[model samples]
Target: MRLPLPALLCCTAASLLLLLLRWRRRRGLWKKVRAARQRQERSLVQMEMAVQRFREQHPSVNVTSILNLPLPELTEKLRDGSLPLEHVFYAYVGKALQMATETNCITEYLQESETQVQKAKPAGKLGLLYGVPVSLKDSIDCQGHDTTLGFIKNINKPVAEDSVVVQVLRRQGAIPFVKTNIPQSLISYDCNNLIFGQTFNPLLYTRSPGGSTGGEGALIGGGGSILGFGTDLGGSLRFPAAFCGICALKPTGNRLSKKGVVSGIRGQKAVAAAVGPLAKDVESLALSMRALLCEDMFSLDSSVPPLPFNEEVYSSTKPLRIGYYETDFFTMPSPAMRRAIRETKQLLEDAGHTLVPFELMNMDYTLFNFCVKGVFADGCASFLGNFKGELEESSLGLFWLMKSPNWLKNVLSWITKPFMPRLSAMLLSVRANTVDEVWSLHHEIEEFSQQFVAQWKKLNLDVMLCPMLGPALGIGYPAKLSVAVSYTMLYNALDFPAGVVPVTMVTDEDEEELKGYQGYYRDYWDRTMAKAFHGSVGLPVAVQCVALPWQEELCLRFMKEVETLVLKNNRLI
Candidate 1:
């Protein structure tokens, strides 16, 4: 088949051109496949490692010994010098290390924490939270620890200075032993990442701990550590506390220092995030808040108002009126949660306090506007920027737009109509609004805030009691519908002082009742909620106590009263 030299050269050239194009196409496809497979492999390895670590970390540790000793008892031991700072530090550090191994709750453990114990002063000079081991979410800066916030690329970067809270905690002699887990971008409710992996509920390994403060919740909730720090803009603290049955507060924005805290959305001032604590009990949460509020944080950052912890607010002895609601404006709470709210109201009323029913103004509009737009207004680019690898499935629920195909996503409004009616309607409602629209929403938020204050004044209430949301949700359920957290996020928008206190535990009866549920709306939200509420039996149920802004002391006092009433009435305390 020998041919002329010119024809042979032409055929060889054509063959080479085709080979080059094919090689480029194959390379691109392989890269995509490799990325997808790597993501899955990493997730599986993380999950397996978490399980293995849990088994190895606490082989002989007495979980009961740690649980039996409450914070007050620990404090007494520390005060009398019976328990050295090292003893307290070791006990919690040991437990936290164990919990972190099992649950993957830690992003960074301070290997040099013993140095903190060795340098601790005697009891006379120690402040309120002295010798206590407090963990911070990875997002908050602590000197000498990398505030990775769960990004692998951030692992090598160490923080140069401590955040304001870290400095305050150190001044009080609290050992910052570990940096707890958080979501990849701190945007989703679920806590999972490629770097530190997923943070599971210590109570139930399969379930979420809640985030962006989920690690704080898991560590404290599991009794691995007590009196930990967490931040909340939209229920980041409250949601995890509620899910794990721990107590927490989301103080009014700017009331707590936001400086030196690392976040994906650094300059998002529209809905400000406030740093606070997650603790084992109500007293712990109060004490932690008081400690942070000592001398006021405004000095460190002038943006914060120079208001000290208003002492007068806590002096009221009156059995004040309280408003109770089972659900927020957006979603009706699960039956067990509603039951918890009703039970709490009955307990309070029986204790000689007035109980009234109240509804948040345009709860639906407020929730849709503030949460969807205000939080993700930057189009999640900021959040996605932190990820050098593939997105975790737990986070996809938050940034839903990322996975959608362009043509289908573009014409979603049209496709939504009559196709998947229930979901269709929700998509139309939840579609992100324009920046100008978000600005208007922000103004409306201010108006809503004023109206909320007016409503509180009209009620003349000391504290309003409500459910934190449904009972302890099923494991992995938070990934399904985190939007339900609006119940807690609503207060954050109002910048009110709200505390979550565990009131009851979900029971068989609650599950049986939930099965017979019937709501007027047959929307997708309703059906999805119904399914999610099914397996959430036998978990803790908690109530949220809310008061006016800067009234944290008053809110805690009222919370104790309600706690006392519930305990005395049920004889559970």
Candidate 2:
């Protein structure tokens, strides 16, 4: 029954030819990816040069003094005509261009911003954020600019109108000058994409600024922009703020409009994405929230509740009950992170605020089953679908996970369960094949949220203080150590208002102490953490402050308390 040798040889040749054709096709696609990236990079370079020319033409503008004033003070100055709109705008543009050139943090909009500045000068103090230069995360829509979200497939696809958030900010006299970069899928914590390349931390080029709000982290952290906006689904806002040594508030969903923001999974709402501020300090964050939550935002998007920032709650003089935790049940925080929580707890206790011990029961299952699972529902098809032709380096790990067949994943989970329970549990939680399954998961999320709220009520805590995962992770660490975000994701799962304030810096002593530390599971993630944090000395360490839903003002107030205490004690670097 065997075929003749000549016939078999002919069949083998045909197979080889098919393989060659496929390889050539892939090579062609890769060439297109490269060309697209080159175009984006060239635009960035030209924008940088233009900014330089503008700066040289206006040498009298003192960006240093303008940047010195926080967002609130700067707004006051603008309203009183003490700070010229052009001067402030160009100062930031100049600084932002310099930072973007160095860190690759900015995507585009320098030219548009220059035009907006000219327009703002005539309008004069129209509203709260008058004359303020606001930076936007790339996912936000700006008319005439591409809301790429770092995908090559999305490159050059210009949005026709401003997002609701952008419209609201513009009405308040805020000029959206430049857009910052983000990770490819806007899902990973490390900020890099094929289109925008990688955004390096201004502090250390080897480390990541954190994401999906990483560009804001680098730009604002480097003092390029005073106030910026970033959307947080998991730890997007707070993680970058912590990594970059800035402050940010991940407000409850619906607090700000998410109408025109581009997301991989547009309608997935189990752990809803929220638009929030990433800024230099707590005051700037509070001011941004006030401006973003105005009547304009509510009218533009009726889904956004008509709730202005509550100044009274933020300025309360009453004593507070603060609950603090050193570890989420799933992982042990690094020494620097642990110290941040412990030190913040000590400072709060000294300030006459009562500190209560708090713990979330079943954090591991809750995070994986509820938060992480919800995000990856549909097996990450929507996320992967965005990759039209090529894949991003940041998404490789996720791609592997998403592309694997369920039967294979189940088999591997069973094989690993005996030795690696955590990995197995993670694998077991990646459900979402049907509407009924997603519905059941959504119901579970609601139940978990209700239970957690009940626990918070019983504790009677004004706010909770906990460790932000670790100091800024090294570049590419997000791929392997994705679960490290569980600390912040827990808040997202509960839909609580959370903020991160810089408390201290990673020190040699902290690094040395962390070497001997063993986490709750002493697994792959802990090993990866030790490696990632080894050379992270002098990187910022921060703590997470959480409050009940719709209590963003209170969250900012507590964050301000931490920032003040840290500054007073000379804890911040």
Candidate 3:
């Protein structure tokens, strides 16, 4: 095998060149990356062109004041002839497109928005929403737009009908303006996919706007859309709301119709995604909830309950017995999150609302046994299968557990036990394989729900103050700390009506505290979490409000109270 030095060098150089060529070839193909890029470019171009055409056809008007005006005031002005539907529609359309440019937040702007605005009745003739423009999360079906949910395979196929929520919005005279971006299948909190690239936080380009409704979060946060409707299976709505410094409500599942929504695998009802609103303010969210839980929605979707908004519960001046928890114990509360909670808890107490200490025990167990298993009963084959013959976004790296064998997970769980007990425990938590195991998982979730309800009743809690995920983790960190969803995912599992209200911003001290964070387990998860909040200063911190099943109005009332208290005052306490 011996060869001259010059001959060996020539052979090695030839091999190196061959390897480089092969690498470049793979990158060139990129598993449909080129097609996805072209699609995104076309979508954005169409949006810009539509906005430009609308501007050309309609006379220009100052929408600054209209944009600043809250939902209630805007609607009132429209009804009183002080504001025109044309101006409001254009204001949102232009701003949404602009925000999309800055943040990559929107998926596709609706072409029929102009038509919707033109046909709209004048001055309160239509409905409660009267000419208000609304943005929808990408998963909510729009008749002519493709709800890709970040999959290339799902592209170019427009829906045949409007999602029930969209129909409800139209019936209320609300124009669905645009469909926002989302992470493909919500494998991570940060929104990114091959189809639409990534959605950066409008507040800070480097930070992530939580998802899968994150596009709505960034768009609304950037003042593009004042009110938007989104869904939450596992904090999809709340995460974005918190990250983007906005308000949102995740109503109990089945409260709003999900008939036409394009979400998880068909017929997989492990954990139902509830549709609700993300708004500039809590009152707007209340209004949205009121509008959605109306007869229009009830009549349109037979699957939903025939329950209208209970004005009495929402408007009641009575004090509430509130339960609160500063930490979920699974993920250590960030300094900003802790402060938001304590301050809100203080404000609630000062407002004569009782704040009882409520602890969320066994979150890791709950997260795995209930949420993860329930959502991925089939070991996530249905989810992973979607990515077949497709380019996968990097955010899905952590979501590859199902691809691994049971023996491997068991071996990893056993191997990592000593050093990373939390990780080991998670690995040890197996997914449902057979139908019998699936039924058992369902029974377990029911039992857990019953137990949670029992505890809520035992505490006599009218509402609860919760620590929300916030201060916008750096990009890619949310996925790394996926289990850190302890705060919001708990509600999703319990099917409670949870809402996020921005209370305060991260301060210098909060940053210091964040730097000093040590996870409860003191494992990699803890250290990674500390590292995750590296650049969290000045970002908005929010507190979550949770209410019992079907008590959305009361939840809104509680959210409004927290928002009011936070805005009112809380001097050196």
Q: Order candidates by TM-score, high to low.
A: 2, 3, 1
2 against 3, candidate with superior TM-score: 2
Model 3, span 150-177: residue lDDT tens? 8777777889999888998888888898
After superposition, which runs of candidate 3 have C-alpha atoms over 4 Å from their true positions? 1-60, 430-432, 570-573
What are the lDDT scores of the predictions, listed in order? 0.72, 0.84, 0.83
After TM-score superposition, the amount by which residue 562's alpha carbon in candidate 1 deviates from its true location, in angstroms, is 2.1
What is the C-alpha lDDT profile of model 1 across 1-573, one tens digit per residue? Answer: 898999999999999999998788656545644553354345335534543454475466444564557777776678678765655565676577678767878766665566777777674566777888888888999887677665555655778999988888888777887778888668767787765667888877766787789999999988888888888877788878878888888888777787878875676656667888888777777777767776635667787777766556665677888887777646777777888888888887777889988876656566656655566555544555566443333354535754344344447747866655434433444444577876887797788889887887798876788778755455555666756767777877778888888878778888888887654355655667787667666677788888888778888888777667767777754
> Candidate 3, which ten residues in sequence have the lowest lDDT sum?
389-398
lDDT value for model 3: 0.83
Output the number of the lDDT-best candidate. 2
Descending-lDDT candidate ranking: 2, 3, 1
The alpha-carbon lDDT assigned to residue 517 of candidate 3 equals 88
The predictions' CA RMSDs to the true structure, in order, are: 6.1, 2.6, 4.7
